[model samples]
Target chain A: MASNVSTKNTNNSNKNGSSSNSVISKLKNTFGLQQLIILIVLFLIYGLFAALSPAFRSGSTLTSIFDASYYVGFLALGVTFVIITAGIDLSIGTSMMCAAITGGVVYNQLHAPLWVALLVILAMATAVGCLNGFLVAKLKLPSFIATLGTMMITRGLSSILSNVQTETFPLRGTSDGWYKSIFRTSGDFPTGAIVLIGVAILCAIILNKTRTGRYIFAIGSNREATRLSGVNVVRSEAMAYIIAGFCAGLAGIAYAATYTTIMPGSGAGFEMDGIAAVVVGGTSLAGGVGSILGTLIGTFIMTVLKVGLPYLNLQPHYQIFITGFVVILAVYADIYRNRKKNQ
Target chain B: MKKKILFGTIFAALLLLVGCSGGNSSSSSKSSGGNSKNIEVVAKGFQHDFWKAVQSGAKQAAKEQGVTMNFVGPKDETAIAEQLEMLNNAVNKKPGAIALAALDTKAEIDAIKTAQEKGIPIIGFDSGVPNAPKGAVKATASTDNYKAGGIAAQHAYDAIKARIDSSATPPRIGIVSQEVNSLSISQRTGGFIDKMVQLLEANPKIGKGKVAVTGHDKFKNKVNASSAKAIIELRVPADVTDAAGKTEASALLKKNDTICVYGSNEFGAKAIINADDSVGGRIGNTEGKVVAVGFDSGKLQINAIKSDKFLGSVTQNPIKIGYEAVSLAVKAAKGQKVKNIDTGVKWYNKDNVDSKEIKPLLYQ
Candidate 1:
């Protein structure tokens, strides 16, 4: 009886050990633990900045970066999903501006109830995204050119809608409403950082654990093969653009929250930051691979550098020079890695 | 399967929660303050740091005066179209009063006219509505821009006169005016020209009232002809096409020596001082190089003045103008009549830039 009981216990222990090992192996295989190295590098860079500038570590300073980061970070995340499919989205930034401005007009100017305005913004953003997807996937236009066209059109549309200045949310004499609450919560850096983290997790789940996510990567890696496998290439690419657009709307709302009014050209030149973050985050511009985590960390690094350098008394324009250097270094490293992988 | 379900459930739940909460929060923000007795005061816009400073000052005044200030405008730089639309929308809302910096002097008159008809008092600031109908505005509070321009010209003469007195030959002077049509920039140029003319009349030996015609000497003589020569050889920034000479100011300095560079506006001033050719080198018999004077206080201009790169600049009480504009609106809303107020401008050299009164004008 004693020997039988010992045998049962030993069998249970062995089963548990193998299950844990399989889980570890699965995590390693699926998520790419190797990329955490970049995260560590980002952390070290942040640490260096925090140590160098007294203001860099201050709550207000950190918060300022976080505040700026939320808009940029959200845009980067949306672009990440698009990039993973080996596509690009240049219109996300302007589309967000258009969405915010349109929403502002509805909610603030026209006095439409706040939720109605938000839905209008969401619908507008999604429609623009759909238009981008339709041109790229359905109409067979090059993703780059398609989005570039969208960027111009959306920018022109935003200007035409607002006539030129930022449309203030909640209007004057009205308190901030639902639009402001979701996107413009008060409290400094961590609030923005926390919001970004929450959104990042949602994107990670959508990208990594979903069927659409798998198809995005598969299509990016080998479009012909993905088609042969009976996955709809057009749908996958279109979906990517739609996702990017939805995220842009989210980013726009975030921007309106943090800043009092959206400036004309508010989202202008922001696509560069998204592209930079995606490229730096280890997404090959050529297609088939990316890291949401890497992009998140990349955003942090960029935002910190942007906010920290200026606080350290370095001129604002000088930060652009450093960012260019970082992008070059990232691309060089990526090329080196590709060569190693090929070998 | 359970994990996937949980994820799906959470995602759906989150969306619903955000959607529901978003609806509730926006309504709450809209209703955060139920006091309808408050007068709505809309600022023209906050595109630049100058606007931000003005907004802050106006808000402070609003709080002290127990009025609500609604500061909103187009988010773009120099977007008059958006400003015009906002004015129309503000008037539609029937705000107690609206304070505006007319985006265009003439384009916004219709909206101002309508708002006046509605009995919503309008107070103009910074760039006042010059063409508003007689009864359209309650009062205008701004720097006497014409006077301010005249001051800039007077200072230019003072600085140049001292240098000319010490020189063997007459010193050539250059003017950088922003827009020929912009009353402010043109007035400053006019004031400077008027002052130079007066000085020249007073001392003809100094070569006053003389126009230096470069390029075609024949064109110089035909003042009324199509290609008439300039009386004063001015090197306006290329961006200022209408300013007698539209070539970049640097080219103007290169073409003529004995040039005393005066920037008629902020952009003109910045371009003149920052130009590579603006290095200190003697102009003709003048022992020192071109003395650069500009209008407006920007960080670059302030620092330049501090370092003696510029002789001095005219500092307008931009914040005072914004604050008074809002205050006047509130008073006018309450049936109190407010007259045109002069916020005023002052000249700041390196020595005075650090002074308490001047420091507030220098954002940096």
Candidate 2:
């Protein structure tokens, strides 16, 4: 077990740089000071909340933070690709709810097995992604406008399909309840955090390593230039939306596992939460620059504040109010970086 | 980099501390329970004045019991996942006891299970987590909305009896409900319909073949709308929105035979009041006015009652719901026997609306 831990650490250090001195030293070259500061800030805020409220430092409270972050973390990771391609997916939030409810309806109404319902959720979300890709890439619709339309359409569709009733997944102890263990176990371990971190790492690889990743950056940097250079800009940009849809599907699964009751007309504000995390993670709205690692840190920051504020007996609105300032500060950092580079 | 980091850290710390200090003072003032034995309350969002009344009541109970309380809810009712997170955090606090108004019970199963296992007794309030695990929920504090609905019907029946009897043409009774999906809303709608129908049947002039119930396919019956001596029609909108509710209410108001109308909650009552404007202000009880009876109180409904525009409204006493929840929670935490507490309802009109007894119960 110790060897396993050491190997994972070795793998992580190899990915970041070479020999592991300090994690900050390893990451500073690739990500620079922005993410390091944000990382420190996330811990600092957490420490402050713990100092103020004795309950905030409990193990269960950490689990609550992980529970809250799962869906949004998956969402932020997925939308990172699209944001890098200079596009936005307004439908991911509603689309995730719509797809998950359809999955639940399949399980209950169709009497399908739980696994089949889970697959249907993934397939339905990907299909929404395909539609998004087709509209923006083939039909040349504005990504924002196209996704906005799908957002409304999917929002209505979920209600129509579920008959406006709430759909619930199996409880953690039921016959088909093992799916919940994918996120959390009966022993109170939060396995979802591990799954989320793994997905984030994989998303980072896809965004930074592969051809689709490079093409996405190119298109965001200069769409006309990328197109003129014989890269299939439409297909590459569309792939980003498709990736987002796939992530939304994963997010839907995480949502179902973590919070079993799925309601229609929900998942609307979720996209904004996801988008805010991405923006807060040092991703420019103008696109072409973002890291999954930064996005991960951003997700933690958001979830920590959300879970921590309540420990101090603060209302949820304070989280939103403070997060607004945090996002503004992060965006200013991006603007400052761009200004410095131009000068 | 050091200066920027220091500045950012200070900025975030200052904001967080400001929030902490400011929020703690307000919450402490709300309860004044220095004992630090926390009772966490997770409620349905404050969609209307209803929840504010509930909060005030919770504060009342907390102050009396000498237990600090932390109250939180999602931004809106549809945010079920967010509510679950709140419930989970409530459990995580390991409060002395928990008072929960679950938005979706099935979604709350896991968190409730955790609370149960941890030996933290949970008191359900305001449509408490129905069908929760066998022993997870200790007791519930809520108005029996169906009973509350019946209370409205009894009052409405009294005011409209003469109107229905004197009408030469078969009089029509209308019901404007917000939606039919939720247990609380639907029960209120069903309760009023069933009770009013029962009351109308017992009357010598309007028995058996007189009442025809119709609308939304849920309440359709063999009695024809045109042929029956009187009609009991239910109007549930396509969605829960003010405009849709107003439209449904207006459709009933425009009909010439309609002599009385009922709205099940604050939203429904407000819709009826708003719809009355488009139809030349017909709702009242003085003479030829269409008698209107409503459930729950709001500013508009209170004003309407003051002017005799509405005959009366049934109020659920949300503050009592909040108060009882914390009281029950404290009892359960003390390992004392606890059972379901019905934080009953009241009917108020111009006669009693401003009276000391009824004034505290009415919201807005």
Candidate 3:
């Protein structure tokens, strides 16, 4: 086991050394060329919208952009782990919504305290993630099929739990509305930005500096080899799913805080947004390579497109069309870079 | 061991799916069986309290009329394909009659035709399918959405007209609609914009300057937006979520010259109220307050109206619409001559919200 760990470290360092031999490759290795390019694209989109509509240039518009990012950001951050392990979680979107709906029911119908309700949201999401992990890690089911079933289950459960009613959280001025401050201040400052950044940094540390993180990367790179080396590959892979689930829980809370109402079966397409963010942020769907920072940047790029398109006097359908093109372009860029690197 | 666990997980998932579908089928069967005539009512979705109230009303009508009403809806309003499938299923059941709140007017034409071929009379409710095949639809029970929007506009204009007269600069009126694609929302928004423009054009003082209506392209072409005195800005979000609506509301609220705002639906109303809360502005007819008028009645919108956070709102008669739809369907099933019914709408302010006429129509 000790030799395996040392050998993995040496392999990582050797790759780093080779990539740093050229100035361009050094920049690519250090900052991640894909993330840098996406960041540039984010700024360009912002600039384009600002140029098109004077209303888009205001602080409120920026606040709206930040507000839209919270739930998607957390979902992207969590699912980055699953994707990093060469796994998919189609359930995250609906799971987050289901968790939020559960919390809403607890708070509104059951008259539970806000803290208990928040914890319930986290617990529900974590259990779902564990289920996904158990199905994939232990049962060896395809991640796609496992999460797809879980997605339908969670969505259906959410509708059943809320009785098909739109569950609303406490508004900002209400006594129990302090939770809204976690995402935005009463004064309308983007306090959620600070929380998102803090969470991103914490996730970065866990992904880069922790033993569990190393094992996760190892399992993703080669599950068979890692298991042969006597690592607990199942547990490590399951832990990745658990982390994804926990992140989804946090996203549920963010969603409840940011929006006025939670509707059942409304979150079906949201996972695609999170997955797109992960991909755009330079996270490989094949796994073994990803960063929390890249996912964060990717999430902002998506929100900017969603919130910015209206300012350009473009219809909402145009935003969807442009987003499709953007995803294709980003993935193409990734493919091009990989080919160049191999050559 | 791995194979066993995999099979177990698959089995569990299958069990869950079977359980859900089983529940649906049993409930539907319970409604369909017995001596009572079964009438399947397909709704847009049960996503809102409005729909639940509609379902309750339908149930009430079914109990009173000695008929069995089977209500089913897609999980969300955007599930057009799912809704089509539900309509097909309702037709396959060959129910006495089918009452539908079609999500897409044109998309359901084929289903309407199918019901026609199957000799199942179709009654349209909430939103009528205007372009359905000839003789396919027997009657429609719906609130006059266009007139309801005009009522909202009339009340809003009454509140803000004083401000319009006093202000030297061209004041702005903002309309936040949930979406432009839905016929119900389009009519509501169009009615408001048209009424506001007509009112402005009638007044010589306001008519001195041009009235420009700008926002979504479909609405922009409906009114003049160039060289305007009162700029009627119509904003519809990309989607039907509160997040999208709130973004549009906040943008409309940012302009200092804006005097009044109208939210065309429940989602839009909540979005306006939310934007107002975040932006911290008075929403009333008093000096320096922006008049906020809304449509539909939800707890949030009702409370906002009661608290003076909103000027007023146009409340749709969803329950009556539901009852009337089922009643008409039952009558049509009996081969009785039935005509279109206007369930009507009421403009409820804080004073009239609890009034005898408006109290029962308010869903929560």
Candidate No. with top DockQ: 2
Better of 1 and 3 by DockQ: 1
Write candidate 3's Cα lDDT for B14-67 as tens digits.
334323433434433444423128788899887667788788889999889988
Chain A TM value for model 3: 0.92
**Superposed Cα deviation of residue B125, candidate 2 (Å):** 1.6
* Best prediction by lDDT: 2
Q: Write one digit per residue (lDDT tens) for candidate 2, span A93-134.
A: 999999999999999889999999999999999999999999
Model 3: CA > 4 A from native? A1-31, A340-343, B1-364
Best by TM-score: 2
TM-score of chain B of each: 0.75, 0.86, 0.79
Q: How many backbone clashes does candidate 1 have?
A: 12
Superposed by TM-score, candidate 3 places the C-alpha of residue B105 at a distance from the truth, in angstroms, of 26
Whole-model lDDT, model 2: 0.83
Q: Candidate 2 chain B — worst ten consecutive residues by lDDT sum?
A: B27-36
lDDT of 3 by residue, A174-199 (tens): 79989988887866688999999998
DockQ of each: 0.03, 0.35, 0.02
Which pairs clash in the backbone of model 2?
Answer: none
Q: CAPRI band of model 3?
A: incorrect
Stretches of model 2 off by over 4 angstroms after superposition: A1-30, A134-142, A223-230, B1-36, B153-262, B266-283, B287-291
